[model samples]
Structures are given as C-alpha cells and as structure tokens.
Target: MLGGFGTLPGKLIWPTSVTTSPDGDLVVKDSGTGHIQIYSPDGDFKQRFPYGFEPIKGMGDVTCMRSGVILVTNGTRIIQLFSKDGELIHELKSPKLTWPYSYGITVMQSNKIAVSDWTDGGKINIIGVDWRMNAILKTNAIEGFHRPVRIAVSKNEDLLVTEGQLFGRFQGCCIKVIDKNRHLKRTIGPRYGKTFSFENPSGISVDSPGNIFVTDEDRNYIVMFNPDSSLSAVIVSEGLQGPSSLSVMEHGLLAVADCYNHCVKIFRYK
Candidate 1:
C-alpha cells in the first residue's frame, strides 16, 4: 500500500467525502456518523462538528470557507456552517427550495457557492456566502448529468463535476466542466478512451495547476486529468474498495475517502 490508512483516535464509518480547509486540516464528511470531522495534516483528529442528529440519518458533502469556517450539507436541503472550533455559525435553508437531492458542492470566488443535485435533470444551485439563494444554473449544465455527484473549482475558477450513476444503476461516469455562468465547457469521458474514462465517479478535486483528480468507486481507481482536461494518468487502480471521494493538496498530497475500507488513504502525487 502506498498511502497509509487513518482512522485517527475515532474510527469513521462510510466517509463519503474528504476536503481540505484553508489552514490545511483534513475535513471529512463522516457520512456514517452524520457529522463532519477535522484532522491535522498528519492524520491526527482535531475537532468534530456538532451533529445532534442520530447516526444513519442523511448527511452530505462538506467544504471550507476562505474564513476557515466549515460548510456541510445536511440532507438534500440544508447547509450548516460552523467555525473551525466547531461552533455553529449559520444554517442556510428554505422551505420553498425545490432541490430534490443534493450531491456536489463547490466554493466560488466572491463568497459564492455552486451546489449540484442528484436528479438526472436538475440544475446546480448557486448561493451567496451570506445565505442568499442566487440563480440556478440550468442551461446545458451538462449533457449526461445522470447524477452530478461531486464538484471542484478549477484553478481558472470554473466548475468541475462528476456524474455518479444513471437512474441509481451506477452506470454514469464522466467529468464535466462548466464556466462561471453554468455553461458546459467540456465533457471528458469514454470518448477519450478507457484510459480517460471513469466508472461511478463520485468525487473530484483540482490542484493549483488545474490538474483534476477523480475517484471512480466502481472501478476502484482515481484518474488524473491535465490542466487542459486531457487524460494524464491513473493515480491508483487496485487495492481500493469503494473509493468515494478525493482531495488534492499542496505538495502533491492526495486524500482518498475509502468508503468500504472505512478509513482515509493519503497518497503522494506529483
């Protein structure tokens, strides 16, 4: 094994996503526990968000604000923002919001965010950092967005999303890039060949060089794409069970949320 597995002081179950805060702490959406946990760069547990709900309830993705606050998705309709010390800062929710399901989340410049949906034909929700619901990006979000499952903001500030499954069949797998206006800019998939394709892509991240890393759960691999969206290489191809999420860090450190393995895997990339 190249990357060491870490459960830290407390074991995490079914971690579906992993991200990094501005300060370099590992932020993981502890899906099985219905909470978010923070860890030091070296795999030491630091803090856990306040998760008043019981385990087995729905808890979704997580992202970090430039202010170092953590933003976590609660179910399909709520966003819980909290400080680094685990204090609740704000909750973004509305009864009238019609997003049937929530999947990916990306923090944009100027205190904006774009959240994707799980529905086959749904739009990405754009909201302000102040909890204001902004415009929903719907025009050609992507051609085959069966379930836009993960998202990341590229170095150019564009949106990168991964399609997870088609009608819950674990069939769709590809990466889509969208401009700031939500227009589809590029679709990288099997059309580029098996080496460039994915199987059940569930997580995505972009490094400073605009390199894209994606986790394909069904295939048990993480593929990398160059800044121009060309297939760069396969970071991992085996010994991984249900790799659900990934986060690209500085100095070529990559974090993988091995869902079935029940631990986080830290890998080296460059």
Candidate 2:
C-alpha cells in the first residue's frame, strides 16, 4: 500500500487515476480532494499540485507524455497540460470537440492523444502531438460504445476502452477493443458469465508485453488479460474496495488507485 490515512506525506482521499512519469515517478489524482500527488518510484510522496484558486471540479484521467508533460481531463471540452513540476502549461480545446465532457486519456506510442468524451453520444477523439484533431471514434466505427470512460492503447495501437455508467443503475459495463484500423475486434465481459462478468470496469492499462489489466470497482478486483484478449487471471481481490485506476510500472510493478480504501496499492504481477 502506498498511501492511506496517516501523518505520512503520501496521503490520498479518493485516488482515481495513477500513471508513471518519464523518470518513473508515480502521479496520482485524488478526485475527492482535487489534488494531484506525485510519489517517487519507491512510494515516497514528493509533491502535490493544488489548483486551489481554480479547483478542478470534474477531474478525470491523467497521463504523462514522453516529454514529461502531464495531460489531465477535467470533464469539460478542454484538456489541461502541466509541467513535471506541476506548473500549468495550457488548455487544449478545439471546435471539433463539440460537446465533450472528456474523461479517459492516454498518450499513444505515436505521440497521439486519445481522449474519451461522454457527451453527445460518447466518442474518442484522437489529437496529434501538435494538439490538432486527428480522428474521432464513435458507434459508427463500432457498435459497442456507450459512455466510454477509460482507454488504454496497446503496442500495436489497438484501443481498449472501458464502458462505464456514471449514475443510476449500472448498464453496459464492458471493455471494447478496437483495432488499429478502427474496427471492433472484440467485446469482453458484462456477458462473460457469472465468473468473468464485470460489474463496474473502471480503470485499464496495458503492460509492456501487451497484456491488459483492468480494475472492477464493484467487484473490487484487478483482472488480467492475455495479449490475445484471453482471461489470464483475477490477480487481486483481497482487502480491496472500489479500485479506480491502474498503471503498469517498470520491473513488473502494477499500481492501483484503491478508491474506497483511500490509497494506492502496488503489486508485483510478473
């Protein structure tokens, strides 16, 4: 466990997204407190970015680019970029993002930015490194996208998205896998029988080997998937509650934002 209630510096209230910096530091967003906490690779809290003057009310997923720039989705039409030292760089907005309430975000190996929007029928907007619109993915491209929340890009550029229900009863909880050519390849869970059904698939991440890791909030477990999208195992489920985000770190380390527990947990899955 990396953070919890204590006098320690790595305290978290409701950690939602966890990612790694270029230098191997862990960057976590505590949505409940609107604070972005930075921790060393060894799990020591280093610093936090406090947007106290302009609180981020709808903070979403956070990702770090190869250039060490951090991108954050704030549940609005725009995305925010910050320096490694937590200094705000600027906000990204475009007319192409008509009614965006951006959520899931990731930096592709090609340096493209993939962002999921929950408004106006749910879509994923791809932006270039120069911050220009590259493409937009929607149900027209695939049949299974309803409120896509989180996204992970595989080594081959395959996009794996988590479909989550924001409010009311849970309705369409599954992971939609789209190939590099924008074709729906597969849809996992929410229908994989009782054993593998996902109640609330929230966080998702891809390892160096192309294996997929997902966090089920309602089930309180982290499940692993093979490179071919086969179920490898339910790697975690003990003493967990409402795990939100997942990030595969270096040296076989996996970091999870245990939301209900108000902390981040690291595991050696390899």
Q: Which of the numbered candidates is closest to the native, going by highest TM-score?
A: 2
TM-score of each: 0.86, 0.89
> Which runs in model 2 stand beyond 4 Å of their true positions?
6-9, 51-59, 131-144
lDDT of 2 by residue, 1-270 (tens): 878854235687778889999999999987766777899999988998863311344447899999898888868777778889999887776565553577889888878778887666577776664534323332222334688888999989999999876664576688999888878889887856356788889899998888999999888989998988888889997878888899999999999998878899999999
Tens-digit lDDT track of model 1 for 1-270 = 112334443468777778899988888876666667788888887776654442224336788888887877655666677888888876666665555576677788756777787655645766654444333233123344666777888756788888776645654467788886678898888445463456678889988878888888888988888989888888899878989888877788999988878778889987
Candidate 1 wrong stretches, greater than 4 Å: 1-9, 52-59, 131-144, 166-171, 194-196
lDDT of 2 at 65: 90
Lowest lDDT sum, 10 consecutive residues, model 2, at 133-142
> Which pairs clash in the backbone of model 1?
none
